[model samples]
Target: WARHGIMTTNLAEAYNAILRKLRPLPLTAIVEGIMYRTTMWMRTRRAVTLQQMSNAQTPFCKKMAEYLQEKANKARFHTVITIGNIRQRWEVTCRTKGGFGSSTGVITHEVTLGHESDNTCSCSCNKPKLLHKPCSHVLAACAKIKLDSTSYVSTFYLKDRVLNV
Candidate 1:
């Protein structure tokens, strides 16, 4: 799951459940049932995607942004330090509590913004690689600079790109 970034096996479970119900049906009946289910699934999914496009952010991106915002709010002791003459790099240090009664700790991460020609950025957390989305550290640095965090989000999570897919 980590290698493929699959968070769950719900799709496989659903397919297995459908197979169990189709086992006692005739061949043509099973085929018709599958076709009907697939058609309905596609229609419902397309409608939801279109509705999400009406918002400022895509559904997936909006959910990620909300999570980042919640984490940023808890990161009250965090600091964003810019580097390089052109400010192409940022070091974000976030202090977090360990547990209910444990001591606090500091975690530092580096985020690199590519040049205008590249239009790319990366975070040391590697969340973008795993989830194909911007990490909280990157969002925190962007917030410090008063930049739009959505600009850093991957195009795959954007409404237009998702719809195209």
Candidate 2:
């Protein structure tokens, strides 16, 4: 997936998997079947999104929200040290994880506030630079500094953007 920091040719593979059941059907029948399935999926997803909005729970479209939450959970095990520099730098140490294995048994990353007015933080892990999503280190730094971690998230992951699409 895009959030995992790399995109590959799996899209065509996924489409091929979707086309498996339609193989025996005529061309028109296959096209109609795909359309019907796509329509149903869209309707169901839209309904779910509407329900989420009604309940005041849709922070982001479900998948991105879950991904962010998983990173937030990891933030709890982080030790964020403010570096107090011009760039508002921070050192985030992973106490319970080995994102990059270290001989000392703790992984650390340097995080800095982005140049933009919006608080788009970046990490030494390079995930934010690559995937357009804040890595756990950035999230941890934001948490320590009382910044809203969500502000660092890419607009591509925003719920409103997804809904409009």
Candidate 3:
């Protein structure tokens, strides 16, 4: 737009808004403000790149659409809590021995599988703080199913939460 000279009156107003906010400052203050906003923009761009890389699916753009759809379905958002075994049936349990100690209380957890945006559980435990790393409970589930303990998920996206809500 700038190359085509399609400038909008709002551009001046936007700059004015920033100037207005820093009107009482000295020269250094204005420079600092510009540098701060520039740094913020750069950081935002880098975060976007990292998130895109983490979320990339296989087979290029073709699979990318389906991968996004799967993510949209929010199929990976739920954490399976085993209360206990049920005589050949499925059982759920939430107890464990580890960072919280051997006799810790029932540790309820919120797992996020699909939604990448809000993909964090609010537990102070060592598990989710590691980000995408499986915790002890996930490890247990993987063992029960004879799979890699790290395969279990612990976070979700908007789709699952919205539907389940």
Candidate 4:
């Protein structure tokens, strides 16, 4: 299954609280303070990411790498089977997992690979196209064919792109 990141209004509420504290200040001073704070945040992020990149082997940023690894770990719980007449098309079925947070039952997805050497992957979940990252289904299908799933991942989450910020 694909993981969906939920972003709520808590961030805007926090920002509003900060702005309320600055409401009595002059508009020019408030704007300058916000700009300076944002600049410092970027600087701090860049420095920390630079250190993380130094020890990393993959091109993906640290978070992205961990996310992909989690997907791969989930992929191991899936059983992929070659379906239809095409070898590139596979059926990825989730194994029965019993736990407090597990799904109701086994679920299956259709994954079609347009090419073996390219990143053209279409899943029933449509996560790769929607999120620009390989979902567990894609990873399972790729593993069945001994293909690398990283090619299907977007470069936007790469270390180089994050470092450029």
Considering every candidate listed, which one attains the maximal lDDT? 4
Clashes of each: 0, 0, 13, 0
TM-score of each: 0.62, 0.72, 0.30, 0.71
C-alpha positional error of residue 94 in candidate 2 after TM-score superposition, expressed in Å? 1.2
The model with the greater lDDT, 1 or 4, is 4
Alpha-carbon runs more than 4 Å astray in model 2: 1-7, 57-59, 95-102, 129-131
Error of 4 at 23 (Å): 8.2
Question: What is the per-residue lDDT of model 3 for residues 79-157, given as tens digits with 9 covering 90 to 100?
Answer: 3454434311112236444436435544554432322244332223434345434444444333445543222333232
lDDT of 1: 0.69
lDDT of 1 by residue, 38-106 (tens): 888877766766887778633454555566677667544568888756757899877655633335577
Candidate 2 residues 40-153, lDDT tens each?
987887776665665446467787788888988988889989886777899888864553466778877899987557657678888898878888888888788777777777
Task: Write down the lDDT of every candidate, Cα atoms only.
Answer: 0.69, 0.78, 0.43, 0.82
lDDT of 4: 0.82
Q: Give the better candidate number (1 or 4) by TM-score.
A: 4
RMSD per model, one decimal: 5.0, 3.7, 15.1, 5.1
Least well predicted 10-residue stretch by lDDT in candidate 1: 95-104
Count: clashes, candidate 1: 0
Ranking by TM-score: 2, 4, 1, 3
Clashing pairs in 2: none
In terms of TM-score, the best-performing candidate is: 2
